[model samples]
Target: MSFNLSTLLMTIITSIIVIVIAIAGTRRLTTGVPKGMQNVLEWLVDFVYGIIGSTIGLKKGANFIFLALTLIMFIFVGNMLGLPMNFITVHDEPFSIFGIDIVTQQMINESEIIENGHKVVDVAWWKSPTADANVTLAMSVSIIILSQIFSIKYLGFKGYVKHYFEPHFLFFPLHIIEDFSKTLTLGFRLYGNIFAGEVLIGVILLMGMAGIVPLAIWQGFSIFVGFIQAYVFTILSMVYISQKISH
Candidate 1:
């Protein structure tokens, strides 16, 4: 539901590092046949463009390609963060960074206790931000807001308002509810998938008692899940935008 402070902090830190690497790679671009980071970035850009073009049409989707790419990259990166790191809990009171305690200890279990009674319980340093409903909801709602703006721009204010009453004025309430439901589903779907994945990985890790084989298998699967979720979210956003903007 709410973000773990450590998770949020980790998300920000990871995002910054990704951005820096991207910038560094991009700045060194050369004209003749891309290599290394340039090759990877180009491929990613082309992949996103292909998705956008297929979903929203090449012409209209061009306007939104960058948004789609950014969303996929950010979400994928956030999801990937929880895969490698582990966290511990300090249970005497709560763990705090700079005088603020962010970890919700209630959500953690006794099984997570590694050593030294309740005074300190070690856990992972960060969780995937997409696992938190608040983060996903914010992302989905922002997309909805942007969709509305595009709808108005393309349809004019009167046309945008009339969209709610399509077929009959009686359908307006249903349409409103549909909009809310879209946001809810979009947000919760990502949160649910990622959160469930994290929890499953944790449980597996515990059961395996730090076994390499199980950890490797689950982490590999988790990476695949993360990429698929990112793609699904991006394509859905493009579809939503296209629906709103197209006549």
Candidate 2:
């Protein structure tokens, strides 16, 4: 399996940024009017809290507040990382990072990537982590699995199984398919949007000076798309968890 170095590096960077913001935003306690970062953060927390409360219920959803907040923040930040620019490099031969061969000599010799009649490796050194299918898929899958565990914890293994047969036994197959479809669509939706945005950005950049106006417009739209994806993913995840755990 091929691994994406850019995805890893960018994910780490996104996580760091999110963690730093969390720490900085809450370092001081405020009983009065929130200011600056704290104000922004409190509003965000209430926004997420209301979404979860609407889905599962404030009583049941209280446990998931932190989870929902973290997911939304990390994903939103991760999606925004690629808006301004991307860092890419070309390697004529094998390449490595941290002593690990990311682009091996064997792959280079066998690669079909050609530019100007020369075989070479093009690597993205930085971009949004959510732009990668694997990254989004892993996040989706993990959230699904976590929901299942919570289902079991709340409903017991017998209830979990029984719910699959719900409203009837014949629904078993459909329930199985529903979970599979949810996982696939959830992951693909985020990846497709971000990756497409990045691809269009690259295309516009090829237009030279003429791209300036449209590029500016597209990036502004991309920022909106990124934030919406993050919010959608978080809210849907809470809904899925509620389906399982609140039955």
Candidate 3:
């Protein structure tokens, strides 16, 4: 009944569908030239590969196809997950996962609820996974860890530490801090933009059917946002790896 609970339910169902599609497509790709869904999936994979290879160099990009594909598919599905709801419901209720405490939706007024006891929370129908800070932070941390792994493999311990200091002694701390800040910003920036877009969509829907006028507009804008976010995520990951491996 709570907003979080509803969001979780929708997200879970959406994720299952995405996973199933991915698995089916993956299995199909191993046998022969891709066809149907497999064809589409392969095209997506190739597109991601092209972008990554061009930006990071073929050797580095080929190694990163796994991360690139995961990000692109996850984000694409997350963005499209909430597209199919005729009526959206919102309510103030408690949420528990496997009997563990999580969060509850707090309602300020009774006027928000309909006769069915469902409160029409603004934009109650769709939620974006990338809109969550935890998801983005988790992804950013993964990229940082992978970069460090590459650094350790390519550069010996001495090189790793020395590279951070760069051309001067005075700027060492600043360089280290900048590296740390990049990880932080990568997470927060993606979360903020995607979440803002999600919220904006909700607001537009609340403005009435005329709001539907802008639905097409926002959908077009969202496609751009989705592609940009995916590219940014991949670019930052590649940049980190390149920085680590560079002399």
| lDDT agreement with native, every candidate | 0.82, 0.89, 0.70
Best by lDDT: 2
Better of 1 and 2 by TM-score: 2
Candidate 3 TM-score, C-alpha based: 0.77
lDDT of 1 by residue, 49-152 (tens): 99988888998778898899889989998889878875654454455567655556544543344355544544456778788787899999999999999999
Best-to-worst ranking by TM-score: 2, 1, 3
Show where candidate 1 strays beyond 4 Å: 1-3, 95-124
TM of each candidate vs. truth: 0.87, 0.94, 0.77
User: How far in Å is the alpha carbon of 124 misplaced in model 2?
Assistant: 0.8
Q: Enumerate clash totals for all models, in the order shown.
A: 10, 0, 1
Please report how far candidate 2 places residue 206 from its true position, in Å: 0.6
TM-score-best of 1 and 3: 1
Q: Of the pair 2 and 3, which is ahead by TM-score?
A: 2
The total of clashing pairs for model 2 equals: 0
Off by over 4 Å in 2: 104-112, 115-117
- Candidate 2 has its poorest 10 consecutive residues by lDDT at 103-112
lDDT of 2 by residue, 93-112 (tens): 56676878886444465443
Q: What is the lDDT of residue 26 in candidate 1?
A: 98
lDDT over C-alpha atoms for residue 185 of model 3 = 94
